[model samples]
Target: MIHPPDRPTELGPGGDNAIAHAMGVAADEWTLLILRYALQDGVRRTAQWQQVLPISSAVLASRLRRMTELGLFSPVEDEEGAAYHLTPRGAALWPVLVCIWAWEARWAEGHPLCLPRMRHLVCGHQFEPCMACRTCGGLVEPREVTGSFGPSGSWPRSAPNTTMRRRSSGSANLGPGFFPESRALIGNRWSAAMLGAAYLGAHRFSEFQRRLGAPATVIADRLRTFRSLGVLEVLGDADRTDRHHYRLTDKGRAFFPVVMSAIEWGQRWFLAPEGPAVVFRHRGSDHPFSVLLLCSACSRPLTGKEMTVD
Candidate 1:
């Protein structure tokens, strides 16, 4: 029998599982689109978000309220209406957003609108953000990082409540200039967990099933989606489905920064009794891996205040 936490921990923000907590709030398609519009277009009011996004007023209000309760957004009542601004915690998600933009711009196909150019104001040049180690000041990649789970990192703790309904395929109608592929991969809790498991050395289909505790059909569906997105490749005998070894493709490996940034954001905002749910270490420096987003043009560290998207 599948045993979840004692409480209904699906969408609520309080939890010891930091990664799960982070995903709970930020890893939804609506949340990502809202954040994009807010950060890039300086959208703050309810009417403003509605004008830019296709989301209903009730859903937008609900998301805003939840984000406010989670410390990501603070609501201010004004003469017109309530305007929500990103808190420091919310502002810290700049790197994650930038990483998503970078991945989608580079890998995703058939964008209906042009993706915005991210400019580093300090360097006065448009650049792609690169992930680097905070300790040794070196570049970080999927292979160079090692992860270990703490007490809170159990599959039960990490898995979202399965009772939560999967999103409809047509629900992601965020107009143009939005992240479709990035949202497809990271926006879903199960898909994010499965991808993370792959990075943590879960290669075979059985391994993914074992680690994620997802249903066989759910696992299969996500694996197929990953393969279709060019994020994973099946090795060994294709006919032997059970023994098929799944590995990350180059495009998949490039998504490491997005994961790292999310992990860092989670560890920073969500507190667990057993410390961080998952601890990552840089192999070359052998130090705790801290994600630093740097500009490709000037190699300088990036901040939300310093970046202008156009």
Candidate 2:
């Protein structure tokens, strides 16, 4: 059965605190913004969030409280008391956030929402984002994936030192996009759940929990992780005080291909006798459909050894 990483039933990352896991959802939008801001500005204060974010004091406090509680951020010693900085978990999200940002600039009609102009770090070219396999020159395809939880048990825990083992799927050779580290992140339960939830339109915490039945702490942590990584956004609600809403940023939305690939894999392996647990639809036609990750060069279904990473 598909289960989230094991957790203690407590309110933190220490033991079997399931509640701690549930609280991670709040980290989605609001918390991620805080982390992203910290990455850019070095540190940030509660007041900065109040002025720039549409979040209410209560919700902001709640989100920050949860992050501090999870050790994702800590107050640094400064003249102004302390500013929020990235913890180990928060730092790990950098690549994920970058990936999401690139996805947005490339796919989402080039929407400008809040994203800064694109910066291609590797090539130093000013352009939109795109993901390529490090090993192969080809693009990543959905069906070509095979993955595991990776070395880390969770954010607070240390990851083991070893090569990732690939799980077989369709007959086609997998593509290069399923790089060792990237696959591990994508295969994670929280990442998958958050991505799946976004595709299902569960933007807010309450709604995500309602739809997925995930604990509050778990949802909160994953959201924070994703946010820190830049997959989700937390916008302050002018009308609501105690609660804030979450949304997949353009980067997060572009991650739809990753989710589509997962859904496709589930359909192949985990489908119940009754029917598919979910189905994707077209907005204009209202027609349900599934997406395929095909090769940009040959337009063929890419998989296994046939694929390479850029």
Candidate 3:
């Protein structure tokens, strides 16, 4: 078994990369799901989350403590026992969770255990949340915008020597036991690159092939898998070849945060000496707005110390 210091649970590169550091705080797979239940299902007690999610009690208790350390959860006393609730910072993850659920429902249709229907308060209909531009309110299409290197992007020069043994899942050295389905999906570098390219407006088979530079066979295999998984859907009537104009489904679009989070983390932790390879910004304005971890309540940036958890 790996020792505690060997696992290195703290996320992001330390020093100067505050967002990177913050992202590191909740890098565990179950933490996000814990936040999801707290935000959506009103699951406050430790037992409630353990019951609803596929997690063990030991793991649940550990993650709850970690999330508490990250300020994602706050303790509240009630009649029965100790309970947990989403702090505003924790509630901010609702969209990310909703999108994840939307993606799961899209890909895992007819599973019989799908989440209950979600109703949009504004439209009074089921709605899928989207990541849109803060400035334009348009979908956060990766291809439509350009950005420059932030301070964090320029520093680091290169990833320093570390014990991390990079693997397809990017967690070989980070220890074991974090085997979420989300990790399984983007475990491979090529799969993740393909998805990122898709978010960057690569709708066609040729587009994916060109952007990823992956061989035709690999591209075809990934595409077929994504199609089967409901992340990509064929544009049947686009006047193009069936395989040429695939698009992101509701679930695929909802997985944007996963992609964005990885990219955001990389922007700080892993960068070339030249700077960030790509940055996203709204077209209307010249100012580039990197995806920030902001609080849902005050719109301030999120750090773990702002609140406490029991």
lDDT of 2 by residue, 21-106 (tens): 32232214445456555654454688886665555677777766666655556657789865776665444344433444445445
Each candidate structure's TM-score, on Cα atoms with residue i matched to residue i, is 0.90, 0.41, 0.54
lDDT tens per residue, model 1, 102-194 = 888889886777677889989899999988889888887779999888766766676554322224666655446577787668766788899
CA lDDT for candidate 3: 0.53
lDDT of 3 by residue, 124-208 (tens): 3454444455554445554445544344442232112221121243332221222334443454455656766676677888887
Ten residues in sequence with the least summed lDDT for candidate 1 = 1-10
TM-score of 1: 0.90
Between prediction 1 and prediction 2, the one with superior lDDT is 1
lDDT (C-alpha) at residue 62 in model 3: 76
**Superposition TM-score, candidate 3 onto the true structure:** 0.54
Better of 2 and 3 by TM-score: 3
In candidate 1, stretches whose alpha carbon ends up further than 4 angstroms from where it belongs are 1-16, 162-167, 171-175
lDDT of each: 0.77, 0.45, 0.53
